[model samples]
Target: MPEGLTDDGLAAMLVRGLRPTRVTLVEHDPRWADRFGARAAELRRVLGERARLVEHVGSTSVPGLAAKPIVDIVVGIDDPDDEQAYLPDLEAIGYDLRVRESQHRCLRAGDPDEPVNLHCYPPEHAETRKYLVFRDRLRSSPEDRERYESVKRDLAQREWRDVNFYAEAKGPVIREILARGGWTD
Candidate 1:
């Protein structure tokens, strides 16, 4: 059984049948910009000042990258574990706590009705903000963006029981780009 999957039997059962969607590289879409802007506004309205450093990060944030069509938003705060400070407000906004991996000092919320991934992290953690930096880097650098797109395309084609493993597979290239961008994580 691969790491991170709760059901080893399920993983074994699905491996033979799983296949990834084909990759598509598109020009920057204006609609993505509009969707992000609207969602950010809503997030700020609900979380108020606690919505610190809300950013549109992930493949969708980067122009011309093939993605799973989910909008990834990063919510940075003073403390991620302190539920009293932000969790209630976020829950009010309709985000469900789908996963909590304190080992990573992070938690993931999901909106099953809507395709969105809300990642909560502490502001003090630089690695947490690296996602934003990476998005920016790819948006501005065509070379880096192309490389990342290629890596993503290849990785997506592989059979993986756990989504986390697919994410981890991109670590090396991501770290290399971060190093080039003078970011240490």
Candidate 2:
């Protein structure tokens, strides 16, 4: 949500208060990395230099971890507020706008069972860096990775109005891991 709001639809995009998102998890699939590579490459090819920080992120990016089957990717741009710079291209490639916030915009593709979450931000945005740091930390430390997965498994069993709530519930552990990984924000 950029400054000077107008559309209530955009405001509600982050919180629909509609149907609940199913909290599902599956065993780590080896092909996830391949999917990420293809998507990243396609983004780079389409967006050229504008796609600066294309990266595989989130739980699915971590190997040997059970996750929601969605390939989450973070793509850094010159300015997330400038939708004209990247939105059209993203939508052209089948990624629909999913979440829009003050300094970020997310797009998605595929169905609920198999989806790709594309998060966008400016090159130096804090959240962009955080995603990379958290992902790398999980990748290198099996202990931390196990801890994260265990929490996700437990939380997935509980009902939620949306996946957003489930994500919020993991905030404590996320901050803890960020601390251990030398990330402070």
Candidate 3:
């Protein structure tokens, strides 16, 4: 578990009994941007003004970086804990609420065929800041981008019970890159 996350919090993040697909990295696809745009539009349509900010994030958002082909999006809302305000609407639109933590709520859209990880957080959450800073840093710094891609490629070959585990394993490298990029939180 990452620092500052309590045992319960870490446990809450785990998708118990849900096995994830083996890690696979593919060359960056330009279609990812289009997909993110479409999804963001859908989210905006569904949430209306409640969707404060919808951003393309994660490796897919960084051009030329190999990723797992999942479109990772960050959706900022007024309050993450207020599920009643948005969860039902999101669920009606085919998003499955998955991980629920203090900082954010995770929802999965699509299925085995096509996957999208939608992360919901308060606009000022530290995790949200990290996502934006790390993504922007990689987008602007080729050296950091290549270093991250190298780590990801190496990690993709390792065994993982859940794909989330693969993401967790990359924590150290992510923190290293974020730190080098001058991200404090």
Candidate 4:
């Protein structure tokens, strides 16, 4: 339904599966760290050396920040575009490839009840560095973390057709915080 996506393309995407719509923000949970560690271990076990680097990114990784319950993780591989090399192993471990882009692949684990976002990017990708730096910046800076949490709380009050839309809406603030932290695109 979004602009630039034709009816056929929209239908195909819908057929693939609709993303969960609930966008509730909850207080930071210490268990999120454990969840990330568990998922990281599984990814490492499955991909072995192919998983060049695995890290916990996004708001969930930041302590004391309100965020959607889903755990966000970034997995760096040799080549993200080469699905043949890692897709099967990831799929075997319950990750369903959802968004396949030129530079990255966004995979999902678990059903609508409990979900995880596994972002796969090639090593040295700017997005990978951005995710790491943004996460670290948020974790280390209380002022930025509070600002992000305020933005998220305000956004959570509105209605969203898809949960991802809410995430996209936070981009400007995220970029501002990243800039304050000296993160360049």
Winning model by lDDT: 3
User: What residue runs in model 2 are displaced by over 4 Å at the alpha carbon?
Assistant: 1-11, 15-17, 111-113
Task: Count clashes in each candidate, considering only residues at least 3 apart in sequence or on different chains.
Answer: 0, 1, 0, 0
Q: What is the per-residue lDDT of model 2 for residues 133-178, given as tens digits with 9 covering 90 to 100?
A: 8998999999999999999999999987656678877888988998
- 1 or 4: which has the higher lDDT? 4
Looking at model 4, the pairs that clash are none
Once fitted onto the true fold, the runs of candidate 1 whose alpha carbons sit more than 4 angstroms away are 1-29, 103-114
Clashing pairs in 1: none
Could you give the candidate ranking by TM-score, starting with the highest? 3, 2, 4, 1
| Candidate 3 residue spans exceeding 4 A from truth | 1-11, 15-21
Cα deviation of 2, candidate 3, in Å = 3.9
lDDT of 2: 0.84
C-alpha positional error of residue 15 in candidate 4 after TM-score superposition, expressed in Å: 7.5
Residue 119's lDDT in candidate 2:
89
Q: lDDT (CA) for every model shown?
A: 0.67, 0.84, 0.86, 0.82
Model 4, residue 162: distance off in Å is: 2.1
Could you tell me the TM-score of candidate 2?
0.90
Better of 1 and 3 by lDDT: 3
lDDT of model 1 at position 140: 83
Full-model lDDT, candidate 4: 0.82
Using all chains and alpha carbons, the TM-scores for the candidates as numbered come to 0.78, 0.90, 0.90, 0.88
In model 4, which runs have C-alpha deviations exceeding 4 angstroms? 1-20, 111-113
